[model samples]
Target: MLIRLLYASRAAEAVTHELIESILSESRSRNPALGITGILCYGADIYMQVLEGSREAVNKLYNEITCDARHRDVTVLHYEEICERRFAGWTMGQVNLAKINPSLLLKYSERPVLDPYAVSGLASVALLEELIATASIVCRP
Candidate 1:
């Protein structure tokens, strides 16, 4: 069965290009082999990612993410069996929230930041859709 899993976490330390690159590199390498596709959004020491793939693969990856040492306060925002992927253009696409206009963020949440912890999972998903519509997500690191 195909599944979609969305989760958010706060960086354990400073958010740097190296750290983001490292994560993207790993995702680009490993996700394709595992049949996972998704988008990653990062800013304000926050990370919000969505993984789409087979149920087992998505679940295992979520478990691994929860145990990863690079981030803390991992929280699942959404998970469901889906008929099709909302993000299928790349093995792992990315959005640098800092690079987007703060007004865009305000459209979804109270403030201009990625605080998935404070919003409904559906609201977060809506933000992802908006990102797709605006062509804000990048495929390469």
Candidate 2:
């Protein structure tokens, strides 16, 4: 069965471009073979990632993240079997939440920052959809 897992966590250390790049590099290299696809949204010290794939693969990845030293307060925002992937185009798409328009962020959350931990999973998913609609994500084919 296929599943989609949405989760959020705080960076254990200050977030940097290099750190994000390292994570994306690892994800892109590892995910496609596992039949996984998803988008990663990041800003400040927060991370929100969506992983879609077989139940086994997705679950394993989530578990790894939960135990990863780079993250803390790893909270699952959503998880469900899905008929199809909302993010099928990229191995691991990315969106820098800092670059997103403040107005768009405000539309989803109480403030202009993307705080997945403070909002419902549905709202976070909606924000991701909006990011896709606005061509905010960048990824490799």
Runs in model 1 lying further than 4 Å from the true structure:
none
Model 2 Cα displacement at 88 (Å)?
0.9
lDDT, model 2, position 51: 98
Write one digit per residue (lDDT tens) for candidate 2, span 58-105.
Answer: 999999999999999999999999999989998999999888889999
Q: Per-residue lDDT tens digits of candidate 1, residues 1-141? A: 899999999999999999999999999999988999999999989999999999999999999999999989999999899999888787999999999999999999999888999999999999999999999999973
Lowest summed lDDT across 10 adjacent residues in model 1 is found at 85-94
| Global Cα RMSD, each model | 0.9, 0.8
The TM-score values for the models, in the order shown, are 0.98, 0.98
Q: What is the lDDT of residue 80 in candidate 2?
A: 93
